[model samples]
Target: MKRTIPPLLTAAALAAGCGTVSTSASSGGGEDAVTVESCGRDVTVDGVPERVVSMHPSLTELLVQLGVGDRVVAQAQDALGEPSPELAAEVDAITSISADVPPTREDLLAQSPDFVISGTEYEFSAEQGFAGYEDLEKAGAPAYVATAGCIDRRSEGAVADTFTDLENLGRIFGVEDRASELVTQAEQDLAEIEEIIGDDDPVRAVQVYVEGGKLYAIGGAVEIDVLRLGGGENLFAGDSRFDDFFAAEVNPEVVVDLQPDAFVFAVNDAAHEEQTRAYLEQTLADTPAVRNGLLVAVDNTYVQPGTLSAITGARIVAEALHG
Candidate 1:
């Protein structure tokens, strides 16, 4: 996967002058330590941050799962309206910062957040137009980028990459034990899924992310790796990365050309789900998947790279394939 540069540093630099420090005795009887390497920067935060700002819904969800949702003071504007019922209560206390527009230094300063957690570094770099790494350093609040959104193909060492991220978050929040428990459960769940599907005939499937009336086929390393765990074959296994395909990509003449036995649609919103369902119903009318009514709709977040992909996503695929 190609990596994109983030814009956080620019804004961080401009907000650089403020410094507020508070100290607390460590429960371990040593100096309280909260240090993390995120977005290529080593950040040592002092004590558990009382006020945290999550710049993406994914981060918000992760924090909530880690039992730190109560600390979040602000969230991205895009995440403000009508969250899933499961997340609505936590979001009620979160103030909105428009991610499409760079958050002003004043806006961030007013939140009095000691830490900022972004879903992707690119959200700060490309979307928010931050200047450089120092920008975050200057803001008196350390910023941590979610590794799940890290585009570094080289750093994705193993399935452990996802587990390590959970541990990293635990370290940041002084809840390392809780993080470990979640990672252990997640790993066990994935392992059980693998055992259940062991030796089964691989079901050929295709995952299409729909946006703006177009279908983008997911492939290359990510989907293939995940599908293999779910005991299924990615129909686009030969492709190296995700690619946008046209009507021609949907060949109708050769039955084998329409190879997938199941279809998964990654829908971004409720409206997108309706649009995708309509598009698939019309275009894939003759495909075995559609003819057999085996279309599956998945949340956009689950299909995208994330910590939840291994367990939650694998379970979804296993059930779909088994069904």
Candidate 2:
């Protein structure tokens, strides 16, 4: 499978970054101390985390790819989605929690997860349902949130961030080698995409989400950077044009005039796809995307960002635009 890690990044380099830093318990090939840094906080792992409760689907996919699917005692339901045949049984075996929200405090505590991985969008916020970092520690589990889900940060783009997550997970699960392999695959995938788009003028695209009968475009490039990196240009890069901050529901007529080459929609599920279909065939009837029929749906979970999702999402967007 094609992956998204940078080509020059060696396995030794990756393993070194995430491997146990201390040799106190290195009698064999064992890790003595492992730590993962997230949102500027360091989360230490004494040994491999056996009971990991993934609060998000992207994280669940990471576990499956890391070859530690059995370590996942339970995961946020639908986090893995309808698995792609190869992983059907593996995903089916794990218990599902809430699909759209954080599992309740009682529900989460019941699982007794040594590590809790959540998307920063909402689940990371304590008041939303699942407790905060402090709460996770109190419950005997270290809190880990995906950096991709973070707001207002560009220190790491999707590709780099995904690798970071994989490395961190590897550190915790003793799977640095597997993580490295995935990274190599990711690098090749990225190289292929870069070659496809190779110095060509970027294809202008307007990505939006349909909610409550309103059309809302993504405000930040953070989540959609993979698309941009894959050569899809954002029509809303400027603040004065689209106001990515407030993300005001723009008049569909406003978008029709942009005449984007492609229409990217946040179609997380079938319902979202159905919704965007209308936007394509009706609301933007006059645009190039509609006329050319260049409509694409991005899984919301995939948008959340992870090594696998980043690579897969990049490929999905690249195919839709230039396939």
Candidate 3:
């Protein structure tokens, strides 16, 4: 793939200085360290971390993409969505230190990790009994949160945020080349999907998450930005109800009134996808999306904040919307 940044992503980088991530080499305490902007904070990692704890599968997958999977000493093995086939074996091999998704402070500290990375800052929530950033810092472990999951960046996140995280990880792990390669591949993949969708009238869709018959619309997050790359416009992207939130419970009547052109839903597996499709078909049979068979199912992981999987999600959306 051609190593290039997408033109649209330039704006993503310039949106806010808080979301921007950069790295600089520093000699602190007679040790080589890399200081990078993460979650609107400056975190310096002294030397490459040989023992790292990944708080979520997304972060774990990203570390693997950066060619530092071997450094991951412990990870949370949650079945949030399907794991990437290419890296499933390697990811599964990583030890799970706790049954909890975000291991407690005690368990995490016991591992004596030098570095800890999480998809969301919530993983470091002291209120939730998990290891906070301060706790990690005091324990000689620097914690880094992905830009997409930053409290200030989550609502306005985009595909470029993932690139920022990738580059930052590369710098931290002394694998800048590998990170660039992955970013280039993602950019090329998105470009190809966009080219295929060129000149097509964008579909008006709503990304919905269903569980126990409750409906939640995904909006004001990176998924909305990713959907646009696939030639779809979210009906609720500008709604105040979804402002600054990933998903919000929406009334079925509201969806029926909008009569969306398509329904882009997230699924954990094929069965989940089929169940969502069936529910849409039966509950909102009058909607154009249901009648026209324009329901698109994307893996849940692909729809999360700033993930390389968004490329795959956008492709799935592009093919369904334009093909």
Candidate 4:
């Protein structure tokens, strides 16, 4: 799936300042020039990007939410979930550069994007043959890494941290007003969730994922914060083993030993949900969660960091735990 770097973005092209970047920001009143710290790097966008490449579904959804869906010329093809009704048309309009896989460097360079955004630093891995920041920079595109995706910043991630992405994108696209309104709405929603879970002891839960006959427990990630927002606490929060890993394999014996009140798990579809529940029921039959039928299933995308649906996820978790 790897392709050689396109000749169009070679040293010669870079020397001549050749690329598809627009020279002006949007007509709306926003800073013509904006700089933000993105994944330990200071990235500056010369003007609002008119042609953007979004490397993750969550970030693409965020762009559509910011009212800039028309500017997205290309997007990653791996969809964790279906687009919301509000975003369906826009999501359908953008061309997908890869299918359920990371887009390659040449694939990205061919688009001549004015800007590029990804949910994680992994999208820009040079070793994996994906376009790196320097590659995008050579094409006159500024790369933006979501704050929630930054490894160093995620240890204490909160659902509110989504605000930073919204605000930063607002400034980048001259849609500050739209961003502000969304933030206000999200805050109000979170407040309501808090009110619902008030004065209740937190639910001790473990967020589990089963893949390829292996079991993993989510730890040291924003998923933990989402769990906390819903009045639940992850048993593996701050576990040194997951300080850098999002989720890791665990012995089934550990789940039996911990005796959590509930199991918050992710599922891809209805059939998968049924299968996961049956597996958990059999594997951990004696655990309180299985015995009490306290397993809560969440959509794959909702639990991802910095997603707007994460608010909905927190509410779902709260309802499952408190009610």
Candidate 5:
């Protein structure tokens, strides 16, 4: 199915008045106003933000990967998934203001943060105690959403956008140098696989997520693009067989017919992972991917757009399909 750029980021452009960006202390500083347009709003970062609050896991994880998690004093506990051991320490120290819901306005105000980072637009609803970005600006705390995390829920989660978000954060925090280092490292990690798989024919595959006996395919461009970059061809990309790219339920018959060479399973926990494996093995036993033992299990974060997850996930897919 064809899709348009989300209205939030439709033809959005970045304008840094000074015409120069610094990787070191050259943040959105000086007399010139730093301009960034996100989800349909133009944001002028008047100054660097010190005290920051992250409202979702992806934002927190990004900060952690960028070496700035220590600065995020508070966040949504539920959104924060299992992290690396070192990040666990950092996450443990921060205040968990909400369990499964966005922190109320009072909760946000209590933090006294200088900047706010939200994962989804839904988090900014009045019900979540956020009157949205304008309210945050009025409260004197400017905020930003990860490029892929805008109002569009077409379910697009892209790693490239994660880098963009990181660059934006670095500009807002005077840490562009650190962001560059992380991006460079990610590029290097991904480059190794690209070199090895360049000659291999692309593998046809359909990645899916499993939850409570239900199967959902992964079709977001952010994720699909990575598959392409990793040297795998997404069978569902304009295959015309899929009626809805965002369909919540999967038809095993479709998988059996497509006969994808790989079955990429995105699971969050051991139980879900085991269930997905069993379902595929029992129902798709005769399928090419299953018969050939090409089932790949990856963390849900792998499809959720984080620096480490994206690089790691792509490498996993490449090794599974090409190696």
Candidate 6:
């Protein structure tokens, strides 16, 4: 069953003056000479981007992390609006592309952005009817897609590949130093976690993202990497992407067959936490995870692919499994 959860409202306030971006050059070289890959295409950014637009929240967060939030002139519709207290102030100056739609070409062109950043190809596809990078080329604006979410699988090496993309972004944004530091920190964090958990005994676990009473199983290399990093085994070893499974497909009898020792619930709001917990308790009462009370709740944001997966995500899972 697939349940649609309402869009989450962020309590964070938008940063003041996000809408009045200035084209004046900074003290240093503008992002004009910078070049970044967008949807597998190389885009040359002439100078430091004076006017920028971001299509995804994850990409927006990445820009901020790189210390270039002030360069952003506009943002996508759902991408704007504060989602958390930490991000509230940054979102203030941004203009919404539309009530609920991604930024249109006219909206983007009006902003006069030198470059645009997106976390995935879906952002471009959903916003522009154009097939690929051609639309961005025609618009005279460079676009970049975070490579973390573009992997063929979510395996350990794939996870490392995603991390490499973060480094690539840092290089493009003139923050190569910071990006390297972050990658080093993330690697150390993962190593420390693995050391603490040790390879002695791995726990069998399954990630269950519940929204609107529907249960979806996450597969692929990325999901598996997360489970392994937490020192757990993924119950579903399929080749399909993350997909939904109905009650019948889940098969009550399969619970015993898979024998997951724990269940991870990904949710957006606190209200649904208890509701999902109760539903899972009732539905899988006979399962080992339920009997042992190993149900855990995680932020939906972290579970989604992006830079946070290497930073906040690793910490969240480490604390859950070890602390």
Estimate the Cα RMSD of every predicted model relative to the unseen true structure. 8.1, 9.1, 7.5, 7.8, 8.1, 8.6
Specify the highest-TM-score model's number. Answer: 3
Q: Rank the candidates by TM-score, best first.
A: 3, 4, 2, 5, 1, 6
User: Lowest summed lDDT over 10 consecutive residues: which window, candidate 4?
Assistant: 6-15
For model 2, the superposed segments whose C-alpha errors exceed 4 Å read 1-31, 77-85, 152-157, 240-248
Residue-level lDDT of model 2, residues 256-275, one tens digit each, is: 87888888765546765887
| Candidate 1 Cα lDDT to native | 0.57
lDDT digits (tens) for residues 133-214 of candidate 4:
7788878888887787764555555667789989889998999999999999999999999988989999889988765566
The global C-alpha lDDT for each of the candidates, from Candidate 1 onward, is: 0.57, 0.65, 0.75, 0.74, 0.64, 0.55
Judged by whole-model lDDT over C-alpha atoms, candidate 2 comes out at 0.65
lDDT of 6: 0.55
RMSD of 3: 7.5
Count of backbone collisions in candidate 5: 2
Among these predictions, the greatest lDDT belongs to 3
Candidate 3 lDDT over 1-323, as tens digits, reads 22122211212222333232232212243267888888767788888999999876666778887888999999863455666778788887888865334577898999999999876666666655677777788788888877877766776778778998888888889999998999899888988998879899999998887766777777766777778888998898678875545567778889999999999887766877788888899888889999999999887767665479878888889999997
Model 5 spans > 4 angstroms off? 1-34, 77-80, 99-110, 125-131, 151-157, 239-247, 306-308
Evaluate model 4: give its lDDT.
Answer: 0.74
- List clash counts for every candidate, in order: 13, 6, 0, 0, 2, 22
List, residue by residue over 1-323, the lDDT tens digit for candidate 6.
12222222110011111121112221223535665553345567665667788765545666676688888777674422224447656755566564334555556667766677754444455223322344555555666655644322222223565565676667667788887776787788778777767654667777665545655554533445666677667777653332321111244455556678887655555766788798779877888888998887765444444544434554556566666
lDDT per residue (tens digit) for residues 149-204 in model 5: 55443245566777777787777777899999888888888789898687999998
lDDT of 3: 0.75
TM-score of each prediction: 0.74, 0.82, 0.87, 0.86, 0.78, 0.73
Q: CA lDDT of 3 in candidate 2?
A: 17
